[model samples]
Each structure stands twice: as C-alpha cells, then as structure tokens.
Target: MTRRSATLAVAGALIVALVAVASFFNLPYVVYSPGPVEDTLGEWNGQQVIRVDGADTFPTEGVLDLTTVGVTSADAELDLLTALRAWLDPDRAVVPRELVYPEGTTAEQSRQQNAAMLANSQQNAEVAALRKLGYDVPEKVVVDAVVEGAPADGVLEPGDVVVSVDGTPVAAPEDVVDAVTAHEPGETVQFVVDRDGEQLTEDITTIAADDDGRALVGFQPTPGFDLPVDIQIGIDDRIGGPSAGMIFAVAIYDTLTPGALLDGKHIAGTGEITADGEVGPIGGIQQKIAAANHDGAELFLAPASNCDEAVEGNNGDMRVVPVETLDDAVTTIESFVAGDTEDLASCPAS
Candidate 1:
C-alpha cells in the first residue's frame, strides 16, 4: 500500500475508536421527549377514561386531551451520544438529571412520590369540578404522616381523623395549622381525633420552626373530602403526575353538566390544579407542546406562568391560550367555539 493510504487508514481507525468511546461515556443528564397524549373525553386501554356514577353525565364531543412529556427514569444512565442526539433534536430536550431525580433520591422513591402526587391530583381535580358545578365539598383534616422524633410522633399517628383542635371544630388542614400557630412554641395544644371508631383526646406540645418563629406540630395533615358524587378516572397505571389535574377537572365538569365543553374541537392542555381551581405551572412544556401538535391538536391550554415556554415551543399551526384558573379555561373554550378569538389571551411572541 502507498504511504499516504496507510496514514489515512490509521486516522480513520482513530476516529472510529473515538466515536465508540464517546457513545459509551455516561453523563449525569437526561433527555425529555414527546410522551403519550390521552383524550380524557375518550377511551384508554379499551375502557372509558372518565366514569361519572350517581350523577347526570352529558355527551362530550371532540377531545379533552391531557399531554405528558417523556422523561428518563431517575436511575437510568445516559451516554454522551444519547444526550447530544436529544440536544440536537428540535422535539427533544436535554436537562440536568437532578431536575427529575433529586439528590439522594432513589428510582423507587421517585416512583412512589410520583404515584402519591397523581392520587392527590385526581382528588383535587374531582373536588374542583364538583365545586365548579355549584356542589359543596365538605372536608375533614386527617393525619397523613407524623414526623419522626417530633412532638406529635407518638401521640398523633397516621390515618387519625381529626375532629377538633383546642375545643374548636376544624374542617380543613389550614384550620389545624392556624390553631397550632395561634399558640406559642412550648404551649400545649389539645387534639381530638377519631381512630377506628374510637374518639381520643391528646395534648401535644409545639416546636418553633428554625426559619420562621411559627409553632409547628410536626405532623402532615391531608384533607379528606365528602364528595357529593363518585367520579372515577381510568388513567393508565404507567402515567403518574399532578400535571393532568386541570384537564381532568375540565373533563369531569363537562361530563356532569349539560352540553359539550369541547364542542367537537380538539384541544390539549397541561397544568397542576388546586381544589379551588387555581392552575399552576409544570415542567417540560416544550415537549408536551410538540406531542400535542404531532397528535393534531387544534388548540392548547397553557398555564399562565408557562406561557413563554409554551409560546416558544408552538409550531405556528396550533393556537395556545393561557389560563390562570379552570374558569379561564372554560371561557377560552366558549370563546373559541363561538369564533370570538380576538380578545383571548395568548403567550407573547418569541
């Protein structure tokens, strides 16, 4: 072989080795891509997504789709090549791994936390929908967890139904917090709880929070509501997160009331909703937008705080409207159906 040909072969061999090494080098980063988008008004896994029993349900048209972003598992290792590919792809993103998996958090722990958040989101969505339809949702504060080595560690166990605090009837978790903070750090607070059909009274001392001087009982309280009707959502077990709460609430409210909310127009949305109908921002708005557009969504509902990112991610074909509450979303739907889109709020231009 010629001398130049031999040197060229050796350089090509070195390039191949470098590429092979780069593909195997792991990085502390994860990729975000378009995930599955479910139509809450339709069926999933051959089952109705939303079932409303003991209450009147109206016929829903079109789709009230909830969009999700595909994320890597907490413990999944990503190589340099994978990260670079995602970064170069317009529909994908490369973000720090710690954003999804916190420090010292295991993959199993992340799954459990996501599952718990999904459960809470379902409950809050139902409550918001019921309240939107002018139904009262009475709540009771229950002991969710007791901090270890805290003042209420032994006295207040998880699953205890709180009846009253210091002779005052408490209906919500905020009421209990208010009562606890009403007293000084070392003051004793009496709690009446119902455990397994047995009513018991216990007095626990409070401790001062390090950052704030407010008194704390060192126990987490979860609100248990007395829902007027049963609303079951058949979401796949594989999907978990609080981002779907707003879409769920809209679907539930539409199911219970008369007329269709979507009006045969395809719409997609994502937001974390509160019991009182407040909408909150979520991560991976760009990937979700790409998924919705790919699925041919005509319109999208974006949380007000996520407007900038949502706008930047838009493909210019689908219209993205910003919503601050569930009511705002309903109004946007109504206006869109009526063809009065001039006054509808949208994200600023990129």
Candidate 2:
C-alpha cells in the first residue's frame, strides 16, 4: 500500500477503537429521565393507592398524579455513550454520581434511606390531610438519629419518643429543640423518653452548636403522630421518596371529601409536604415536569421554589401552576375546575 493510504488506514482503525472504548467506558455520572406518573386517586397493582377507613369516602373523578423521575441506581455504571445520549436529550439530565449517592454510601444504604424517607413522608401526608379536614393528629418528638461522638450519642437512640425535657412536655420536634436550647452549654439536661412503650429518663450534657452558641443535644428529631383515622397508601415498593407527600395528602383529602377535586381533569405534581400544609422543594423537578407532560397531564403543580426550573424545563404542552402550600394547590385545582384561571399562580408568569 502507499504510505499515505497506510497512514489513513491506521487513523481509521484508531478511530474505531476509540469509539468502542468510549461506548464501554463507565462514567462517574448518573442519568435521570422522565419516569412514570402514578395517579393517587387510581389503582396500583389492582389496588387503590389511597384507602381510608373510619371515614366516609365519596366516588371521585379525575386524576391527581404524583410524578416521579427515573434515576440510575446508586451502583449503576453509566458508559460514555449513555451519558452523551442523556446530555443530548432535553428531557433527560446527567448529574455527578457523588451528588446523588454521596461518598462512602452503598446502594443498600441508599435504598434504606429512601425507604425511611418514604415512610415518614406518608405519615406526614396523612397528618396534613386529616388536619386540613378538621381531624386532630397529636404528635410527639421521636429521635431519628444521633451524631456519633456527640453529647447524646450514647444517651439517646433512634425510635425513642421524647416525652419531655427538663420536665417540660414535648409535643413536637421543635419542643425538644426549644427545651434543649433553653439551657447553656455544659449543663446537664433531663430527658424523659418512651422506649418500646416503656418510660425512661436520661440526662445528657448539652454541647454548643458549631454554627451558633446555642445549646444542642446532637441528635435529629422527627415528628411522631397518632393519626385519628386509618389511612393506607398503596404504592409500589420500588418507588421510595418524600417528594410525593403533597400529592398523597391531596389524594387523601379528595377521598374523604364529598366532591371531586380535579373534576375529571388530569393533573400531576411533585413536592415534599409538611404536616402544616407547607410544600417543600424536591430534586429532579425538570425530569418530573417532563414526565408529567408526557403522561398526559393537563396541569402541573410545582413547588414555588421549583418554579424557575419547571419553567425552564417545560415543553409548553401543559400549564405549570406554582403552589407554595397545600391550600394553594387546592385553591388552584378548585379554580381550574371552575374554569376561573385569573389570578392563579403560574410558572414564567409574565
């Protein structure tokens, strides 16, 4: 062969080998794409997603979908070709693996965390929905986690219900914080906790907060509620997260109420909900918006904090309503059903 032709052939071979290697090389990123949109008012695996007992439920019309984003597993390897494809697709997103999984986190640990978050979200959703309907849900402060080497590390354990602190009754998680912060650093504080239905008292010295000078017990507390009614949420075991709290609350409210909230219109949303009806921002808002739009959602409810991302990700196929609270969502849905769109908050409002 001629020298020029031989060089050209070698270059072509190198290019082919590079392409093959690129296709097989694993990237340190994760891909996120539009996932399934499940209607809380409908059924999953032939069973109602939301079932309430000890209350009268009326037949509801329309869809109240809780949108989700399909994320690559914590341990899943993404090749260069797959990453490139995800980057090119406007509906898909590529994020660093560390951002999603963090350092030293195993796939099993990630799944456990997600499951715990999902369980807590479901409990909070029920509380929010029931309280909005005039039902009382009494709550107590429960220990969720204790920081190692901290003051409460050996004293407090998870699942221990904080009944009181320094003889002050603890009704909520904030109560525990307030009780702890009321004392100065190095002061020993008494905590009465319930462990496995048995009452126990323990004392631990307080430590100064790293960010501020306030006293801290060095443990995370979450609200534990005694729900007035029995509400069961049937969702796939594969889907686990707190982002569906807002939609779960709304769906439960609709089931308990006498009228249809959506009025046969299709709607989808994503947000973490507090017991006080506040809507919190969640991850993967862009991918969720794409999922909702593709799943035939006529209107989408987005947390106000996520409005900017939602607007940027939207394809203009569906209207995106920005909601700050559960009340805002109900009001928006009611207005939409009534055909009154004036004064409603929308993403990219101009």
Candidate 3:
C-alpha cells in the first residue's frame, strides 16, 4: 500500500477508537425515567398503607396511586450512550448531574436528605389529613400508653400532655426521654402535665430497661401531634422523598371517613404537603406524571405550581388537575367522582 493509504487507514482506526471511548465513558449527567406507582388505598405485603386504630375505617373503593420517578443515583455512573438514548426518548429526560446530586454531595448525604424529607412529609400528611376532617391534633408530647406495673402506671395517664420534664421545656418525645435518661435507675423525675386543660405536677421513679439498660419512664411518648386515633402510615421503605405527601393525606382521610373518595375511579398524584394543608411543588413532576399515565390513572393531581411542566410532557390520557392544598385535592376527587369534572381546575396545555 502507498504511504497515503497507510496514513488514512491509521486515521480511521484512531477515529474508531475515539468513538468507542466516547460511547463507554461516564458522563456528568443523570437520566430521569418513570418509576413504580403505588396505590395508597391498597395494601403492601398484606399490610394496609394507612393503618388507623381507635377510629372507624370504612370500606374504600377504587384507586389512589402515588407516583414516583426513577433517576440516576448520585453514586451511579452514566455513560454517553445511555445519556444519548435518554435524550432521544420523549418519555425520559437527561439533566446535568449537578442539578440532581448537586456539586460536592456524596451518595450517603443524598440518601440522608431524602430520608429526612420522607419523615417530615409523612408527619405533615398525618396532621393535614386529620385537621381537614375537623379534628384538632395539637402539637405536643402526649402520653400514648402507660405500661402496666411500670414506673408511670399510677402517676401518668394516657391522655396527659407532657409540658416539661425536670424543668426543661419538652418540645418533642425525645426531650422527655433525654430528661428521664439523665437520671439513674430508681431516681425520681419531676414531670408537669396538662390533663383536660388542668395542669398538674407528678414525680415518677425511673426503672432500668431490660434491653438497653437505659432509664425508662414506663409511658410511650408520641413525638408528633396529640392524635386522637392511632394512625400508622406504612409504605415501601425503599421509596424516598416528599412527593407522595398529598396522596398519603388523601388516602388517610378516605380511610377514616365514610363513602369512597374516588368512587371507583382510578387517580394518581404527587405533591409536598405542609402541616397547614398547603401543597408544595416537587421535583421530577414530569416523570411522575408519565408513571401515573402509564399505570392507567384516570385522573392526576398536580401541585398548582407545577402545571406548566406537568402539562408539557405527561400523556393526556389522564386529566391533570392542579391543586394548591389538600382541600383542593379533596374537592377535585369529589368532583371527578360526581361526574362534575367540567368545572375543576385544570392545567393549561403546553
């Protein structure tokens, strides 16, 4: 072969190697895709998603699914080929890695943030649901149960609201525990409680716990609001983030009240709920909407602030309704069930 032919062949080989490297190299971006859609009104592993004790739960009909989005984890590597595929797919999205995992964020830090958001979301969901039903759930550290033949049996009652322990202000159940554990076994701890609007002071002798050897007050302290009923929100622990807050509140309300909230119609939604029943926008709304659409939801509840993006991408197979609060969600569901969907708040088309 001539020298020119040999040079051209070598250049071609180098180009091929570069292309191969580009296809296999990790990219500084993440892909967003549809994830699992869970029915809030249904059960997971034979356990109800929303468990209610000390309250009557009626038989609920139809579906209330909470949507999720699948995204590349902070620790996961994304190649150029994968990013190209995602960019080509209309249902999926490719975003900068910093937009998702953020700069200087570790995988463990991302997981911890998600876990914290999930916990706060659940607490807010419980409070919003109960308060929407006209039940006042005050924020306080209340005695839930007193152990029989234990240190607090005679001194503390189930309905007593713990004000303070040993003169320290009690903001949460942990506060009471810290105060009690500060004392050694067999030590008396002073507690001030409000019983039926009447304040009273009592002293309870601490006992050593068999499991951890920690001092025990013999009463179960609930850190959240003084809920009248025992409300347990159970879902897949693998699910993280606050996007399911509105759906959870709606499902809990449906379980505690009479008549079906969905009326046999399937629905899905995503939002971050506050203690005041306000719904906030969440990330990956487009991906969540796609998941809901793929799961055959007849209606979708969207945070009012997310209307633009939700309408732009999600399949119009399901009606996307904008809701600003839990009250708006309830109203939207009721209207959808009543066949009065004409006047409901809707997202403008993109």
Q: List the residue pairs that clash in candidate 1.
A: none
Q: What tens digits encode model 1's per-residue C-alpha lDDT throughout 1-350?
A: 99999999999999999989998898989899989999999997887899988898899999888999888888789998889889889889999988888888888898888888988999999999999999999888989999999999989889898999999999989999999999999999999999988999999999998899889989999998879999899988878889999999999988888898788999999999999999999998888888898899888898999998875584458888899999998999999988999999877622
Tell me the spans in candidate 3 whose CA falls farther than 4 Å from its real position. Answer: 1-18, 141-223
TM-score for each prediction?
Answer: 0.89, 0.85, 0.74
lDDT of each: 0.90, 0.89, 0.89
**Candidate 2, backbone clash total:** 0
Q: Write the per-residue lDDT of candidate 2 for residues 1-350, one digit (tens) a residue.
A: 99999999999999999989999899889998988888899999998999988889988899888988898988779999899999999999999999889988888999999999999889889999999999888888899999999989988899999998999898888888888899999999999999999999999999899899899979999989878799999998878889999999999999999989889999999899999899999999988888888888888889999888875575456888899888998998999889898877788721
What is the descending TM-score order? 1, 2, 3
* Tens digit per residue, CA lDDT, model 3, 1-350: 99999999999999999879988799899999988999999999899899999888999999999999898989889998899899988779998898888788988898888886887788889999999988888888989789999989998998789999998779888888899998899999999999999999998888899998889979988755767778888888778899899999999999989999888999999999997899999988888888888899989999999998875566667889999999999999999899997798778632
Which model scores highest in TM-score? 1
**How good is model 3 by TM-score?**
0.74
Minimal lDDT window, size 10, model 2: 308-317
Evaluation by lDDT, superior candidate among 2 and 3: 2
RMSD to the true structure for each prediction, in A, is: 2.8, 3.4, 8.4
